[model samples]
Target: MIVKFFKNSGGGSANATMNYLLGKENDREGARLLSGDPELTKRLSDSLNFQNRYTVGVLSFEEVNLPDDDKRAIMESFESSLLAGLDKDQYNMTWIEHTDKERLELNFVIANVELTTGKRLQPYFDRVDRPLVENWKQVTNHEYGLTDPHDPDKAQAVKTLNRQNLPKEVQQLKAQI
Candidate 1:
């Protein structure tokens, strides 16, 4: 499974910056962290600042039997990876577990990002429900804001016809007119 989390940039240029950070070039190190590979995490974090306000986790996971020791090892590895990935800033990690008669699930709140103005931002991570290639279709078709381009209320009729679509005499008359 692959999960992505994003924080909303208020709008305009802030949104562009967020988009760039999520791109391949700026997020190469962050992508390494998501791979659950310790060596890559170490190498990538050495050269990049993962603690930036726009930092997002792009996590990938495989299913395994639930074992305490194995879980501990994975968690510890992620903690070390995150620490090395981030810059020198205070951080908080929260873990949430929910159990019902049918199922039990665990969620890790790795970190909460804070803006320069001292406001804590909400994390907006999305779980990719499909394969990466199919997921591209979802992203490509997604509409981010409230506006709709094809809304009837906002549409206007074109006043002029194409010259090729017009009668030949109409074209000559339009030239004279």
Candidate 2:
């Protein structure tokens, strides 16, 4: 599974962000809330005055189709592994599942504030948390036999470097070369 993180705009962005994730904007199909309450999550985020109200991320599985139960289990395991330091009650995570694409995606919005003390809870820090997150991803991918994100050769862009996936203009330019 490939992990991706999206920056949260500000305290008020949580409302709009939740709306988009819950498909309130486009009336998008197949976007279902698998866990947590959006309203409560927003409230928790707003309670603490921080530059970033929350953290948004997506767990994208490589084209291997799995049952909903299996996916949920995987997500649970991922949360446990990544956020082991934070207690379950300290932070609130809103999980949404999208099946519109070829790969299954588990999107999550975690409120940065702690529930008990209203303190900030940053799950993945760059310099400090990189090794832990990377190790987890590598071990998880190996355990599930998923595509290794660290391997450039396994990437779709590298695999199709003939420029077939690029836009017409880019493809034409490549052909001209």
Which candidate comes out best when scored by lDDT? Answer: 2
Name model 1 segments beyond 4 Å from true. Answer: 4-65, 83-89, 98-105, 110-177
- Per-candidate TM equals 0.28, 0.78
How does model 1 fare in lDDT?
A: 0.36
Candidate lDDT (C-alpha), each: 0.36, 0.77
lDDT of 1 by residue, 11-115 (tens): 223234323333334342231121232332223323333343333343323332235554345445444444444432444433322232123223343333432
Q: With candidate 2 superimposed using the best TM-score fit, by how many Å does residue 113's alpha carbon deviate from the native?
A: 1.1
Clashing residue pairs in candidate 1 (N, C-alpha, C atoms within 3 angstroms): 4-126, 5-125, 6-124
Top TM-score model: 2
Q: Score residue 36 of candidate 2 by CA lDDT.
A: 88
